[model samples]
Target: LLLLGLMRDEDTSDPEPLDRSGVDDDRLRLVFTCCHPALGLDARVALTLRVVGGLEVPEVARALLTTESTMYQRLVRAKRKITAARIPYRVPAADELPDRVHGVLHVIHLVYTEGHVASSGDDLLRVDLCREAIRLARLVADLMPADAEALGLLAHLLLTDARRAARTDARGRPVALEDQDRGRWDRDAVVEGTAILEHALGLGPPGPFQVQAAIAALHAEAPHWDATDWPQIAALYGELARIAPSPVVTVNRAAALAMADGPHVGLALLAGLEADERIDRYQPFHATRAELLARSGDSDGAAAAYRRAIELTGNAAEREALTERSRRALGR
Candidate 1:
């Protein structure tokens, strides 16, 4: 969801750039139609993932955790509804654009997110999906050139994707951002992304995507992990939490807070967030809590949290890395 009003004080001085590119207007309109607000959130996501993200029906089914037949039926019903309701397959007029941009932006974000860090797979990074997402993002940005959030999203994807080359080790193990080799990052993409972000920020009212882009921009600007402005990143995450509250956001905020303050402070934040039962099943929550516990000198607690995280983890490389950390935490 492209939220508003939470980051009135967000820094726009160091504007980041976005990917500037062309798009097939027809394709862009078709995607907007697929993401029309008339459809259910699941339907919109499934349709956009299937049509715009270039995912096979089965892939979409797997991503959404539904049977192929069920997903097929849902897609069929959604298309029927669109036609029966006489939804236009063309771009909306200026007056109608605002109502639809939210869904379009959200679905695109989800596509890139799943691609950047696959929810379930043997491999950590899905390059094909990532490329498709970037392509779709470029289309969205081109279609809505003045939309700050659109540009912000494109910049966020580009800036994050710029570090793809260094996200894993030669042994195929996932590398944490703090440990990645900056030399391996794509400088060209970084430059392009920063430019886009600057334009998005200059558009005035910043939203969720712009805030996220700012966070990524900060990371990109840092010369080393130690040099990262943890205080500012944590503060920004606070704004993100206010704008768009989610368990995942809370987890990220806690982790960043830990870096800025102390492990105990981060653990306090997590403790409050963990009251939500959904957090129990989220891998990142446990993974982050485990690290915090380890940092706070609670070896047994860290090991236990790591075990829970390992159980929830899907990627094989990530699982292996967590296993190693678990072993180290237990002094095995």
Candidate 2:
């Protein structure tokens, strides 16, 4: 009976684990290990997007606020350093996985942030980067099955990615959550994300990523934006802020409050955050602020905020989207 049960377990288990111990893993390890703190942030961003996110050289350069030649040189230098240092691409020892995971989280965070509100051109969102980060997160989660943080990170990315379909209109203009077509959401992503989130929660009390994942999941399960559990989302965001406070989190929490309470309350919170040095040039800061203002019936101020957001945009698609918002806000 014991032998029969063992056989059954073997059959039901995953056929293959995505082990981070092969040559490819070694190369990935080398890339992150070579990422010296001395390098420029721009160079780091470019290398990560190219090597980790599989972005083309041109795409990376465009995103980095530099020409292709300059971007290529930076990548070459980064690669040379990895080769010279003889950095191995293999996964760190189990004892070192936590530290290694911190590094991986940083890179994935950078990739996702770039996608959320690109630093340079026109389009606001980079679906490729977002997808790549989710892929990387999955690999990390599989490698550290016992780590709640890994599961949480993957869950958060998956749940957020599920919203991509409703984030924009047919013309790629930004679609406010309240006006988004819930029917258009990516159902598969939501289902997978929900499963990942449940696993993360089962592992332990929620961590930062788990809280964010919960917020995303709430948004995902809502039949429509109007029916969203805004109070729960606000509470989750509050927990996230305590765990990983940032201007971005604060803004998102305020937005959740606005949805739950009223736009005026949300507007005050947004106004209070206007001078936060961390968000001085972040396009989404202005974009969200504009959205609140627009809702508050300050069309002229909203138009100005939207225009500033346009000026700071990086992706072409995002720029066009912001321009449309500005035009509409200005009643042009």
Candidate 3:
């Protein structure tokens, strides 16, 4: 939803460098206002978590034990009500800001996730969304300088966004991470990300964002794909699974395990999720499964998985890429 972008349109320009030196209590004032009382408690809570809490629609669905399609309908219904009622956005009182900071962090997180890889778009990445999310995350980190999660989330975005230049090829076709040219990455962003990550980890116990930042930090620190500390990444993913416990996290952990351990190790975990139905339509799950199956020499299975992934992909080029992978799997 547009809510995942800027809370308002006017904040789009970063005319000058951001100030991270002090706290701004009202940095995410709009986040608290999103939980308007007119909406039903469940819908408000879900919407707040989505708009403010940073949870993805699918993750919120899982929290409610409902399908994402069902959850999306509820979200739409809530938004319509808010719009019809002309709900006002107000900054929370200073006393109320503490309770809502976590939700604001999530808002930034989900926005970045959507921008990192759009759910439905011709383009693989939504640069506008990424920029907005990063800007908001910077604000939150600056305002809540003592909050580790805020610092971790900012680090995560910076570390991940650092690869934007190499994520696609000269022709704009999305390149797989292993195939991406590391030399093209933004070194400045990586340096900043690692520095923030170190400071965040030193603050206190790691939360989901900090753990994820650690994982991204490992990837950023690697000189090359094979040089990546996959075992450490896998371990961090395991920690993240404990902290977040979502299908996305689970799938990612499996992928990291595949890199750290073997294709078989990843396959074993994915096989358990195959019957869950909740992730049957999730493109990444199918894509990851297809790759692992291909590595395990299950040509038929790989081809089937790849076709499923292709069918689920919204991007035309990505569909074509998956189709090509399927063909190779069948041939090999």
Candidate 4:
């Protein structure tokens, strides 16, 4: 995670005059324009990559595997709409910060998710996006240093990215955490993230992002997957679910439960989630379902769930891993 690139540069223009209160108006305008609610989620993400990352049009096209012309058109349209909406560039007022911050966090999540489980292109991991997102998050934290949500978000990304070196194999295949070579983990990043989490805790009460960061910190401290404090992780996930209850969160929490209690317990928890229409199309739900079923000795059901997960998402790495799991479950 390289948030080091947000430093002020000679190429960047000087700050403009602030609004009535004398805060830098140009900076505030950039934030509002970058995270404008009117922009579609995908559009917002793309625009942020271009503007914040200072990526060349061709570089973005290469990263996303799209043509330069197409990316140019998209950016042009996005700029016009932001200008039309007259969104400001600075951080939102206290009353509006929550919604604005959520937009920024969502963009970071989207970028890291793409890196963790790339949706297209030949590579499974897009380290560039992950690093870029971390860089952007650092900028956000700098802009709102006192904001616990922003700091927690940065910490979460840092800790998660710290495990990147161990997430896959030499051939780019998926490596389950239990089987990963911990020696390859980025210890420096882990230490940095833990420090950031501590700083975030000192800021204010814990939020969903802080809870998630705590879970990541736990993982970072473990010497091996089996050494992971599953019970603590489960509790953290519980807190996250309470603060930001989503079917996906519950599904992930179930995985920790399976590790903490038993496969049967996790199976029971997941049973109630089958009707969670909010994440019906989400890949992790079926992936978790398959894992629980396999651990519960329902090989047939596990295989079916794995197959369904593969069909639901086009992320090559995840799809490949799902297919492999399905084959193993069926003893093929």
Candidate 5:
């Protein structure tokens, strides 16, 4: 009878373990291994999310905006590469650490970015994904106490996340940063992020992450929207553009220029981007153009630009917000 009961219990037992407390070390090890320099950056991101972040194949694929089959093949290939190359499941040696660590940081940043603004989803923010990224980032920061970029990345995430409560209205419409309620901002996150940014800046000359963190810090420190250091923010954007040189950065700089100099100046900068085939269809480009046009008293032009932006974006929340902006622009 005892043997019979034991067999029945074994048959009914769960195949997977219920407790995951012991998996943290394994997760960290997998992340470090997946981020090995031997793998491509895309592969590193895919593998790390799959093995370390504990994301399912379909979820990772959705975040990457790729098909499940494609993502599955990518994960399989990454695993094969790891095995065939004999990449050790451990942190890199001190001599080989810096280069490898950058890839890991990039993966973590990508994860956080997807969470902060999902590639394709109904919800504007995926709280679970964002929290997971923060958890992994914290682990990375803990593991590399002296890495400025890691700390800066964490600081940036924290500072950005501090505004989560005020990012949307009661009805779930997106709220512009300038209009968000400062009282709702996470004070503890702001304080921690500021300390982290200061520590990172003290480490050495600022890298791209450090520079971005500085920008976030300035925003967080501002008492009010009008009191924000627009000149300093624009200066930081200039520095970021010099270092990064992406179309997105250019658009951001244009927005800052509108705040610092004037809407006309910002519109002129955006005009060049609008004509560029590479970013002409980019949603943010049109959205920024809409705002700058509205600020310049071109109501009709602003309405048209907002319509174009609405057409380009897929996020329902962003679309609804753009529609509202379009309505306001048209005085309807």
Candidate 6:
């Protein structure tokens, strides 16, 4: 028989040669592979951003809102785990695509979320993280053209990013969506995102991402806050709640209800969520509650809620914004 032992040794010993010209493809592969289901979600996201997104350890730490030392240790552990487990650095095969794709999507979404709202940084938005996320999302959508959710996610991120210009004032204070100057929005991103959303919606049944993109599209198309289709947005949020059913989604739904119906209706909805221990410390919940209370003429209660929100968040910019809101509430 042939020297089968020697052949096996060669196969095991030699690593595949790197293709330098295909750096972007390699990065994409690294992200998808690193975000494998076998790894912890947190580790997967950190490693993917660190390695594939080519973000420095400190930048990754900032995006994740953790210390650099902790992030470095986490990255070291992830690489060690990958090597020990012999996790391949290639994309998943067709049979294993679904689970791997979901993991990758989840990691990308997390990255985008951090970029959209820096969890602990002084800056209200991390443009670099947002750009990285959008780039990765576009790559994923291009690679999986048939994946409706991928397209929807890409569209959703683009639509959100399109508003980056108007998200804050010249003084770096956060601007409410209604108060943002529509003229400052990115028309190119709006066009592309709307087109992608339409394509995604055409491909399959409306998933949570698609629904979210549709809602964003509505906001993008509206000329002014008063022109927004609140009833349609409320309906979409209702559908998203049914499909996704998260506390965050419920909060958003409550906001939409407040817009569509009245402040009292939203306040009633939020009253049920106030006792939920899981989200009691979540800043958005308190902020939304403050808004609803303010709209309902409960200035004292709104001020208290705003103060609680300001206390819960670590981002200095976010704290400043909330403090301003609290001051306004107290003054009212």
TM per candidate comes to 0.83, 0.76, 0.81, 0.77, 0.80, 0.83
Error of 5 at 126 (Å): 0.7
Global local distance difference test of model 2: 0.71
Candidate 4 yields a Cα-based lDDT of 0.74
Each candidate's lDDT (Cα)?
0.81, 0.71, 0.77, 0.74, 0.78, 0.80
lDDT of 4 by residue, 265-320 (tens): 87787788777553556667788988889888888888888877788656577677
lDDT of 3 by residue, 1-332 (tens): 46534334344443322323334534354454465556665576568657654557876665444678989999998877766555546544445556656766765676677677765556777787788788878877776788899899999999999999998777667888888899999999999999999999999999999998888888988999989999999999989888788888889999999998999999998878877776876888999999999999988888888878888786766776677667766774
* Error at 284, model 4, angstroms: 0.9
The list of candidate 6 runs beyond 4 A from truth reads 1-23, 40-81, 93-96
| Stretches > 4 Å off in candidate 2 | 1-23, 34-51, 54-87, 116-125, 329-332
Better of 3 and 6 by TM-score: 6
Number of the top-ranking candidate, with lDDT as the measure: 1
- Cα-based RMSD of candidate 4: 7.0
Ranking by TM-score: 1, 6, 3, 5, 4, 2
Cα shift from native, residue 21, model 6 (Å) = 14
Ranked by lDDT, top first: 1, 6, 5, 3, 4, 2
Residue 72's C-alpha lDDT in candidate 5?
88
Error of 2 at 24 (Å): 3.7
Return the lDDT, model 3, position 194.
94
Distance from true location, Cα of 305 in model 3, Å: 0.6
